[model samples]
Target: MSWARIMAPLSGGEGDATALAAAVRLAEPFGAEVAGVYTPADVADVMPWMGEGFLGGVQTTALESLKEAAAAGEAKAREAMSHVTYGKNAFVSLQTPVWSGLSAESRLSDVIVFNGDSARGRGPLAEAFQQMVADEQRPVLVARGEFSVGGPIAVAWDGGKEASRAARLALPLLEKASRVVILAAPKASSRTFDPTRLQAYYAARGVTAEIDILPDSGDAAPLLLYAAGKVGAEILVAGAFGHPRLQEFIFGGTTRSLLAAEAPTLFLSH
Candidate 1:
């Protein structure tokens, strides 16, 4: 499989540069288009709170302030995109209804990119990240600390549907890796499956992978991280497991642990 477009949602925050850089790095190998999408705050969302007959100066000033902030954010996002000097790049400034535009762009793109802050729910694009991964079920690459492409990559597999989908969607990236390792803990879970099945699957696609069966452990995140580090992997491909609760996502144990750790770049799909 080949990736044609990579979407990076820029929030005009500290994470924009990391997200854009990672997008460019991924796009360089396949000559994919790096779409730098600027998601500004939507002013329409606050209109209902102001009441119906509240077209007074207070509302006017609030609206103006929102507009000015949006304008400034767009400018910052554009400046961040200008620094990316690899592959095809496009700067897109979303309109007032920014969420809809972001969803549309993410659906059309092959994979979405975010930085660690956004992925960890500590940035302006945190909601966007959650929406794309949990609601839209889009693949995302959480770039952290100088992401490197074409390096040793690791895949976390458990023979589940979610893991299978993540492995399949990450085929394009796996093809570019210098080495691929599949980390599986067969005894850690209740599921009975073969890790070799994934190995054979990759082999059939002209991608050779080594399987590392981890020992029985209560948690799989630490083992996966250690194994990835042992192999000097710069990227880890895994499935994101989470459920929606009151418009927020409650991630699975392993997924949450991985997100909290300072590990490799994560390529995840829900």
Candidate 2:
């Protein structure tokens, strides 16, 4: 069976379990392997204070908090894993303590799922999640209020490389969708990208897609969302873009905006 793993950052919080449970439910149909990812918190106290005597005490506290975060993360992971009883293919593995700046645990997984709670807070967990989607080339699905899976799927297209990548990556789910709406936001300046090319690509892939030219709105994300709701799309697919210089530090406005919107979305970055 085709497998897609659901990975979420484990910071002791309210909806961590809910996010994992939602992933488990989404994975059930594919008999997918569901895994929980833990990236331990970095204690700010690790950096030494001005005086020499203060170093030892600060280091000790930092080490203890790191231990506590790890222990807490592992405990939560175990609890979430136990709740997943759907299939034998599923398992949870805790990541060993690694230094900061390493790649995200979700980079290797098929699809990464993020809980929507992060949108409101000033927490690093949410910040890390935003960076992961914008920086990583992998597809990510952000879960909203409740775990609702399997509904109409919508594709937002500008006939760019990124948009094409999103369509290709989401084809498996798109095939199962009751209806697939391809919302194109074509602009006048782009002569190379045209309707025929976009339609042919989907047709060759055996997707019976219906195309609609998105209205000239100030923003494309909401415009696409509007079309999605019109067709009753539960999942949104689109290409993501980022500023070249701060690409690692910040996600593009469109990707950040969509994730902030808390719609179940799959994004591909160029």
Candidate 3:
């Protein structure tokens, strides 16, 4: 296992459970530890919905609701841990206001998993994924409905340092794959790279992988996904990129699109 530990931020529900399962499956292969960081409800997300943040009864009720949700989420994490076969589990209780605490937690872990929650657009999970995987530059596995850890691995290679690092970080999964394929996008400029070099890099690590160029088409996400489908890859691993201007961050071209991907889980890093 390339990762010594992987963390799943539990939001309580099926998505969290699925993420936990994915993390455990990945961790177990290398005897890595799995930690579920439970953050039930952000006070900001709840307080606003609760209407006019107040004191006394209203405040008490809100606190109680938060506590109940937290407890249930912790229970869910514990239950999921119980079913995991090999990896050891640890629990973390974090109720961060702006998700800063969660972000900090991510820095120490090898990989983080969460649901895409794309329908909500740039919601918390989506933004958090971008923040961790793209902004703070960590490897993250974003899942939606149902996700399984092992299968033919598809890697999106762009020949940049980020993509190279991401491939290196995902070596364990690639090594385990029955088949490995690289999806390289058409280069927009003369400073282009050949995917064959990446394939050779993997060769040194004893992973047999081939490269395929995706259609230089309209939407990046769909095109990559379509190519991945052609290769029958179960999941995608890519390097995420984004930059901050003013107080906001703009996600990398393809990275933003993958956040909305539903069919396959995305394993990404910065």
Choose the strongest candidate by lDDT. Answer: 1
lDDT of candidate model 3 versus the reference: 0.72
lDDT of each: 0.88, 0.63, 0.72
Clashes of 1: 0
Off by over 4 Å in 1: 242-252
Clash totals, every prediction = 0, 0, 0
Q: Per-residue lDDT tens digits of candidate 3, residues 1-270?
A: 477888887655666666777777768877788888776567666666556646678688877887787778768767766666653888787765647788788888998877666222443355566567656777887765454455788998777777788888898888888889998876532338889998999999999998888766654577788888787787888876532422323533666666656667777777
What TM-score do all the candidates reach, one by one?
Answer: 0.94, 0.81, 0.78
Q: For candidate 1, write residues 1-270 as lDDT tens digits.
A: 799999999988777888988898888888899999999889878988998987899899999999999999888999898888874999999996888988999999999999888888887888998899888999999987676778899999998877888999999989988999999998876788898999999999999999999998988889999999999999999988733334234445777788887879999998
Per-residue C-alpha lDDT of model 2 across residues 1-270, encoded as one tens digit per residue: 155665656555556676676677667667667766655565443444433555577667867777787787767766766676667434443444332332545666777666676533345366556566555666666666443455677887776677778778777677666777788766521434665576677778776778878766556667777777788777788876633526623744555567557565444444
Number of the predicted model whose TM-score against the real structure is largest = 1
Models ranked on TM-score: 1, 2, 3
**Model 3 residue 183 lDDT score:** 89
* Alpha carbon lDDT at 66, candidate 3: 73
Q: Cα RMSD for candidate 2?
A: 3.7
Model 3 TM-score (2 dp): 0.78
